[model samples]
Target: MPPSLKPHLNGWYRSLKATSRSGLRVERATNQPLAALRGALGVAIALFGALALSGPAMATSAALGAQMAGMATFQRSYRPRPWLALATALGLAVSTFVGYVASPWPALFLCVVALWSFGAGLAWVGGQTAGILASMTVAVMLVVVSLTESVSQAAQHAGVIAAGGVIQALLVLVWPVNRWGAHREALAEACASMADYARRLRHDPFAPFDPDPLMAAREAAVVTPGQARSRPAELTGVRPLVERMRPAMSALADPRVGAAEEGPERDRARELLAAAADILDMAAHTIRSGVSPKIPERAYAALALPDDGPILHGIARHTALRLIGLLAEVHDALETPPDDDSPRYLPRPGVRELLPLTVVAIRRNWTWRSAVLRHAVRVAVVVTLAEGIGMALPYGHGYWAAMTAMMVMRPDFSQTYSRGVARLAGTVVGVGVASAVMVAARPAPWVCGALAVVAVGGAYLTMRAGYMALSTLVTVYVVFLLSMDGLTLSRTAAERVGMTLLGGLLAFAAYAVWPTWQTVRLPHRLADQISAAGQYAAATLEAFASPGPVTRRAMRDALLDYRAARAALRAADDSAATEPVRHRGLRPSQLSDARAAVAAIGRTSMLIEAHAPTATAPSPGAAAFAGVVRDQLTIAAVAARTGTKVDLTPVRDAYQLWSDSADGTPDEILRDASILTEAVTGLEESLN
Candidate 1:
């Protein structure tokens, strides 16, 4: 109580507040380091166990686990699911059927090329798809077919792996437990990440973050899955499933959550926060029940879903601080945060410049060229490269190293970069662990199968969550598999290490050779996105004015396209080479602009798709509202510059009119329409 202690007490209190605040920023959304490590360990052990069970089990576990882990966040899209799965099965069957008629290599060579070409659509200008199921399918077919002196024997074995994946998928459908397991994992990760982020932000004051509710919501949605099938367009397996929940997921960024700017921005944030909270409830209900989560009439009604109150607030506060911290890290990282506005986590620049491809056109729509013959030559090229390496190196098995690289090499630098990083890390860790195990208790050859099984499990787990871990587990088990034939563990591990390093280096070189990063002109990309956004915004508003599935789909597609293009432009610019990193790209500033524009568009898109609440627009007059919206867009930009933040007040009359037009409740439409109008208005202001 003495005056002498007052100054010290105040300083201590101040320090405590600062620490807690900063802790909210730097740490990621979760603090599951121990769990992550455990997951990694489980992966290692599973993989080791798979190989020990014999090749059939190994193959089954690898493919099955891969499919399961990959499909965690998938939504139930019955549309293309059966078609894709059946088609994939038929393709494998035909390939296997053919392997019985001829030697595996010649046939596999054709298959691999077909696989490569078939997958080429995934590339974004100058990028080539890598490590597709086609490759694995061909590889498994060839390995099984070639294992025996006779051709029919190989087909039978290869069929086992395919059948395994099918059976596993069927089990997933019948009993959603497996699917939910992954959802649980994802949810835990999201929760932990949030907790961790909050903890970290309390320490670092300059972390970069923004209204990243979409991201957090994504994390939440990722954990709340009904597991859909994989699509070629998605880089991550569960993309479609995750995306279907976007409308609901958007609530994670509830305005109550992320709007950190003062004044109207705060109110806008609160509205969104309230909406997001409702959607989050819907999502939770849907995922937990394995059925759809119907939201209440009131958007923020989810706030009443038990005790998510503090957690939701924590998510918002931590994210705000986290952004500030990321800013500091980025400045320290690449010298600066590319440009002022955060350039998003992933970049995609929409380059519509379609170089007339004799190959692509044939592959996409033309049925004639998507065959075995077209594929053979491609496989031959890869084989020749591998063989050439084999001949060049004193080690007869050096070709395996080349094969490893060939397996990973892709057309895009970004993917290649990611693959290389994952492969490199996986190999090193696998080798290290394998070395340690071998040194501690040298196992028998038969026991090597057990090791292989454990390794495969590790690979399965890591393949989705941690690339490096996958590589490591795969590497160790692969070494064990090779050792089954009396090869020394030390030698095998050594070769694996050497092979992985060589593979990564050579694959990266191939990626660099004619690499297409697709962001050569970012301002153009921004212009394209902005232009499309304007049209899309108009279209979306029009759709809202008169809703239809076709318009909604078009809007979603355009929005997706814009975001992808923006990502490309941002990455290209940031990686701004004095000389292009490989050749074609844009300046980093251009990327920044593209990214910012994308975010603005994305925010607006969320509003467009949002479930509206009641009340009406300020004016039902379209022309007058358009002009007002335009002005708001401008003000929004200025607000961003001035740090006043954009206003998201609803268009009152428009909402009531919309309510009258649609069968939905008037109040809901009124509130949502108003919010969307305001967001669009703010966005338009920013864009101009």
Candidate 2:
């Protein structure tokens, strides 16, 4: 090839890569833009109608519709009922009424108390909707208090807000979207994501692994299933399977496993993975179609290995064995259905059960060392201080200060900083646009009402896109909200900007005074993850040895516990990564080791979850070796908990025994056991 042609080709390739990466993000955003838009439009219409009927005196009602639009934070699986809307309305009414009845000092004290209590309640509830409701409710009350100093006015505002909620509820009922359908969609997307990963592995076994698609799917699946008795069992059952497949998929995609020279074995492994991807694709189809696919006979027979091979070749071969096991698990997962007798997703708790559960949640997370508790305290301090300052300043909007404080401050340093920046930038743009509109158009009350509805729609549509977009839309929303009362438009924009800046500064200052750095939390998070993984490993092994109802239940519980622990660790790690250079305590190498250790254990658990070759009879020596591997895993976990290094002689000894077993076991069990032993050793080394 000509030199000039080569340069142009390489440049073209780089451009293509960049374009494709950007395109992927844009595609994901636009994928369901329509549904999001439709939901937004519904809220907008409700708000518009409410404003048209009640005029400026009842403008707060439109805020309810805006809240509902944003509050679609409920789990994807459960259909939100009108009762939730009413519940929100009740909460908002209480916040407004309480704020109005109290003077500044009393209000500050009450606000502090309320923030703490609500934070505890949210911790107990542990759902998306609960957090959203808690935050938004407190924010709206602060806004109301700033807008109206008298109890009578506050009461009127609260009443109208409740009416808006009813209107939003009616809209939801009139054109209901099925939460179960959304669950199915999320699950199907997860399966497709996994399948895509598998396909990539098959084509370029050395390709860089990206877990984002699957992670996003898992996050989306966090919603509780609906209360309806008719909810599909598959909806709840697919979560665990998808999670179990993640590590196995990562194992196959490891570039080290694909570094060997191309040969028959490598070619065969690729074909098997291709076949696995097909099966996963079919499983996704079953999820979507609600029709079971016939489990085909073993697509490829377990490979026969020579007595020995090159180290890399051996590694590649072992990966193939693991992949085969995972494929079988997927196949069986599709063939079998969730238990027929399994109850519908736990019905939404009744009003009677809500407080008790909230109490339980608070108790569970009420420690002085708890991140949630600390965050609650920070919020109380920041908000109360902001409100006091706003009240003292004639030009300040007290509610704006309180609202920004509530919205921006977070438990983690990174999130708090990011939210503060986004909120400030968004406010600047939003206020500027709103100020321009008010000054230039000076529209009638009815036109402002319509614009308010549009703003609500805009807020909903861009909510997930980013904070900047959400902040802009919300600012526009606030503008229209204030216009209804015919407030002085001339200085409104300037005052809002000042208040927002004040609130943002307060949030940052509060955090600086009492920060909860992720690095400080890393030890506990990593320990929890290791402990959970250990429990899961033990339960999985026990279930393999004795496949009984009790063992299965224990395994399932442990799996869920492990998943939660891992999530916590990841969250902390991400926050730590975002810390400024001066604030970082842990080195990149140490963090990498921690991650690798976790992944190693995860792969071990997945291998064990494939049932440990129960059909094959193992020799006594092999059985003992398996026990040693289990013991070593426990030892590694204990060391992780204690934050120490430990000797791995037991694991090394077991590996030697397994390598010299008297009677040959099936390659599947042998390879599985071998992988488990390696994981135990890897974990020990990582911890060291």
Q: After superposing candidate 2, which stretches have Cα over 4 Å from the reference?
A: 1-55, 61-70, 73-84, 103-128, 147-153, 177-181, 200-269, 282-357, 581-586, 611-643, 650-671
Tens-digit per-residue lDDT, 243-275, candidate 2: 666555555444433324366655655666666
Best-fitting candidate, measured by TM-score? 2
Each prediction's TM-score against the native? 0.52, 0.77
- Measured over all alpha carbons after superposition, the RMSD of each candidate to the real structure, in angstroms, is 16.2, 8.8
**Candidate 1 lDDT, tens digit per residue, 158-250?**
454445445434433443333233343443333233333333333332222232333333433331112222211111222232343333334
Question: Candidate 2 — which pairs collide?
Answer: 75-223, 124-361
Q: What is the C-alpha lDDT of each candidate?
A: 0.43, 0.63
lDDT of 1 at 409: 48
Where is model 2 poorest over a 10-residue stretch in terms of lDDT? Answer: 22-31
Native-to-model Cα distance after best TM-score fit, residue 282 in candidate 2, in Å: 4.9
The TM-score of candidate 1 is 0.52
